[model samples]
Target: MRITGYRALNTVQEWGRAVGDANGVYADGLTEVPMVLVTTDEGITGVGMGPHVELDAVFAAIDGEDPRGVTALYDRMLRQMFKAGHAGTVFGTIGAFDTALWDIKAKAAGEPLWRLLGGRDRVVPAYASGLDIDLDDEDLIRTYQQYAEHGLRTAKLKGGLDVERDRHRLSLVRDVLTEAGGGARPGLMLDANECWSRKQAVRHVAELERTLDLIWVEEPVRRWDAEGLAAVGRGVRAAVASGENLSGLEQFRPLLAAGALDIVQTASVWGITHFLRVAALAHGHDLPVSPIGTNPVGLLHAAASVPNHLASELQVLQPPVGVALDLRIEDGAFVLGDSPGLGVVLDEELIGACELQPATSSFDGPGVRPERAGHRLLAAAG
Candidate 1:
């Protein structure tokens, strides 16, 4: 079926506020999550949600294209991206189209998304994340304890601000795992949100290794610093994890070629088409890949299907506020069923009730405020 039309859902939702990571604070009890809904000629629709941006060009790229010809459509779009003129909106559009196309494709095949991707019925391992770094000691411990209680084997905490505080919190994360007792204490991860300097990352990692065991150190230096990131990896025993902010192979190539990352995390760069390419690239380098997103609608199936996937990163908070489906977690994983498409059954009422937003996530990052704007990142502007 050809894509008939597309609409963006840029609305203020409580889901954004209560849940967020180390990059920024999202709650004054308010925040906006941008989502896009695409409909096919047959009336089938799919939803893609992430950082919102202008996507007129993206819509133009997909209009009338065969929904099942997603990868072919992706090549055309990628080739035209330069003329289309920029990053945030481009990735946003691709993400939306990818989800919608995959949804339609799986539905047409009458199979669950995971199955369509060659997965037999099984749980996608999940890592507890999507936590607000602003939490205090008591609440932080309590929150992590909750994740362990939910059967999560791995959990991540936002870092790169205060080394002492980060160290203390990580120790507490280990404690929380210990307290939940049954088997081994849970695996722990840390994402710095591209906030630390390479030297700082090395120093902190050295200290942290002395105490808690981390599965990896995410975005430890500026995301664009391929060499610096590799240096940090060389200096530390802990593996370096990145790629949430990366665009695609052009970016992943240098990072991997330089021996920069030990683990690769991807989201909606060039949709699943490009993500698969990157995953294949990472696999060639013997790197494990995982998906990172505040909401994982477009990521779950693909993340679960990757052979070297450690676990799919699910925001520790999004479920409570709710998503398109009743995503259930069991034995530290997100389970998918026989439902066709992405298996996301939208809460139409929730989608309808959301207040229209003026603006949402920008290129720099999500949760960036008006006051925080007016700056470029790393070496240049995207």
Candidate 2:
């Protein structure tokens, strides 16, 4: 089978709570458009989510393609295009298409992607991610309490602003867990979102080292600061975790080799196939992997396919509008579905009915911006 056509859908929704990460303050919520890539052969179609691509250009690039040569086709697009910007939203868009191609291949073969990945017992553990940073002490505790009741084993808190405020919040969460019992004290992790400099990261995180009992402190310094990240990893009481911004196995070699990062996180932008490749490279060095989310579909597939991954990141609060694609999340772990490839499907009627729209231009804002191409490639391979 070959890809006969492709399409893009960009949707925006008002986030219930403003989310702050190493990226910046998402004050008015976020406008995230989930691009869909459609591949058809004999009219049977497979769909994947490509984020921001000049979708028109993407269609022209891969309109007529071999369904089997998914990897080669992906490389062809990368090699041919002068990918602008650091992470290449366009290439990331390509990732969506590559995913669609894989779905088609798996469906044709009558097996799931996990089976292809050296099949293990399905269903991997999940942790609640995309938690709001601005919640008050009371609300934060309530949130953790709720997750604990739901059978979640772990939770990640967003950190990186006021040291005192963060400390207070962590203390509250710890206290709630202690008080609530019923394994309310799930494993805790922290993500700084690269909001601090090397020096600041060291000082601020040191304060929580003894108190929080963090499973890992993610992106405390910055994405490309090898020396700085190494310093934070060495100095902190918690294990230092990073690499969600990273792509390609070669680029991740150095961070793994240097032992600068404790957990090597990969995102869906690399697609599930490459995700495992990077995971294996990290595993070779005895490093664990934690893949990021693009909603239930990608998260479930990655959790199923990659055995070495620590936990799949789930956005409990997805944007308020647009399509509702739900995967079961009980007790902090994602429940996988038996329905064919990726198992989850987008409601097109819901997509059309929803008012969420994509941003007209790229969001240029404060905090650490996306990296440059050369720098990212170097960081990945360093």
Candidate 3:
């Protein structure tokens, strides 16, 4: 099929808070960007995230490219944006197109996205993410307990803010685990969201050594700090987990070569097409892939087929208000159905209702309000 139309819908959604991490508080319960690409003639449409500016740019890049040549079109669009830097802000744009292209391919094949990659597995393991870091320790523990009750065996907690307070919180989680009464304690992991310094990460890892049995400690330092990540990897007893912020496969080269991380979390940075390349490299190194994103999509499908995949990250929130698609979670895993094309159909009405208007802030980073017309990361600008 040929090209058709590209639309970027910027709408508000209740983004949950991530507490006790580099970002002091994390919540953008407002207009979030969603971009959708529609191909007519064949009447196939794909939906993904746009993060505002990047979505518009993606539309401009491949507005008329042949939908069948998704791989070629993806490369052409991505290569054109190279000089603009390859991480952070660029991913929002890249990820949008990636998901859309996958949608097109699946529609063409007349198969579910999961089966295109590999047949659906019984269930995909998940970790609880999007925990509001601002919650009190009691609240956090209670929340985790509730997840444990729901058959979730692995979960991620936020960290990298205050060393002392983080330690206390970790201890509380462990206490709850003991009280919950299981054969082995539920798997506990941490994501600092690029908040800590190398020194702080080292100290935190030393404290958690063999205590809580963390699957990994994610993004202990800033995203680009290869040396710091490597140092933490070498110094820590727990595995070093990262790679949610990198754009393409090339950016992960240094981290892998330097042996900076134990688990590599690759997302649909420009969608599953590039994510496969990153997963292949991580597999070659015998490292596990932990792709972060909620629900059943092509990205989740990629993780399910890859042998090296450890688990998938699921947001600890109900589906967006008015969303109709339901990807069920049972015993800490997702159940994918036999539906065609990513197994998700956007609730057009819901999408329209939440259409983004104007927001005081942008997705630049935590707490960084939009200034002028451009987005700014809180950590970098401050």
Candidate 4:
């Protein structure tokens, strides 16, 4: 079916607790979830979740193209924005349209996305990520306990500001998971969100390694610092995981060539095609790839087809407002149902009814890096 037009909407994810990393936290614990609904000439529609920036420009490339030709159209969309560059939010816009096209393609095939993508298994392994750097000790325990009840034995905590606090918090999460798993060795991970310098990353992770056995340390240094990432990987026992902030495969070449990352990562918001491409690239390097997102159901389908998928980050147990997924987290894995195309259904009524709240502060939010993040070492020295 040929593509017709698209509609954009916004919904909010009520995290129930403050969510943030080394960058900053939304004290109110609310974050916006952007969505797009692409319609076709045959009355078939597909929904995609991501940012809305450059939507009109990007969608123009596929306005009348066949949605089933998703891969070819994905490339065409990139070329459509060649002069303007397809990085940052523009890439996210492309990703949103790409996912929508994939959704339409799968639905048209009358098969679930996993089967359409040639995934043999319906279950994908998962790890809990609470974005809990700002959470107190009691809240932290409560948060992980909820995930453990769902049989999640692995968890990643947000930290990197203070070594002592990170150590304490990591221990707490480990104990929670261990208890839930009947004394099984629980897997623990840390995400510094690129707040530390190379030396600080090495030192901080080294200290934590003395006690906690981290499965991986994520974004210890900046997203693009290949040398710094390699240094951190060399000094720490846990594998270094990054690349969620990176936009495209070209951005990952440097890190891969430098042997910097042990575990490669991509955000779900980047869309399904990008994850498949990144997974293939990481597989060539003999490295495991993981996906990071609040609800990475789409990427999880793509992950099922990749042989090198390590584990996917399960940020929240529930989806955002107005969104529903045909998947269940069971026995430490995501059990995807046989719903055709992404298995995501959006309630237009609920979404339209939800009020959109503006940012509380420019300095405090998910992507806003803290002012003193990389300068913590100098501050300590002084």
**Which candidate number would show the highest lDDT if scored against the true structure?**
4
TM-score of each: 0.88, 0.86, 0.86, 0.97
TM-score of predicted model 4?
A: 0.97
Q: Which candidate's TM-score is highest?
A: 4
Off by over 4 Å in 1: 11-23, 84-86, 268-270, 317-323, 355-382
lDDT of 3 by residue, 1-382 (tens): 6667776654444654333334534334443445556564577887665444455565666777777677777787677676766456576577677677777777788876677777557367877764546667667877777766656766777765554566677777766665665656767777777665687677766776645577789888776677889999888778888887787777899988988878888764447777777888999999988887543256776777778878888764455444434367777677766666666566667767754443435533453422321122222321
How well is each residue in 1-382 modelled by candidate 4, as lDDT tens digits?
7999999988888888888877777888788888889999988899888888889999999999999999999999899987778988789889889988888998998888999999999999999999998888999999999999999999999888778888899999999998898899999999988889899899989999998899899999999999999999999999999999898899999999999999999998999999999999999999999999987888998999999999999988888988999999999899999989989999889888988563554235767876777777542310
In the predicted model 4, the residue pairs found to clash are: none
TM-score winner between candidates 1 and 4: 4
lDDT of 1 by residue, 1-382 (tens): 7888887765454543344444565445355556678888888887666544546666777788888887877766666566655455576567666777777888888887777877765588888874657777787777776677667767788766666777788878777776676657678788877656677778777888887788899888877789999999998888899987788578788898899999988875346665677788888988888887756755677766677777777664444233556357777788876788777766657656755442433333344523322122321111
Give the Å error, residue 314, model 2.
Answer: 1.8
Poorest stretch of ten by lDDT in candidate 3: 373-382
lDDT of each: 0.70, 0.65, 0.67, 0.89
Q: Give per-residue lDDT, candidate 4, residue 257.
A: 97
Error of 2 at 32 (Å): 1.6
Ranking by TM-score: 4, 1, 3, 2
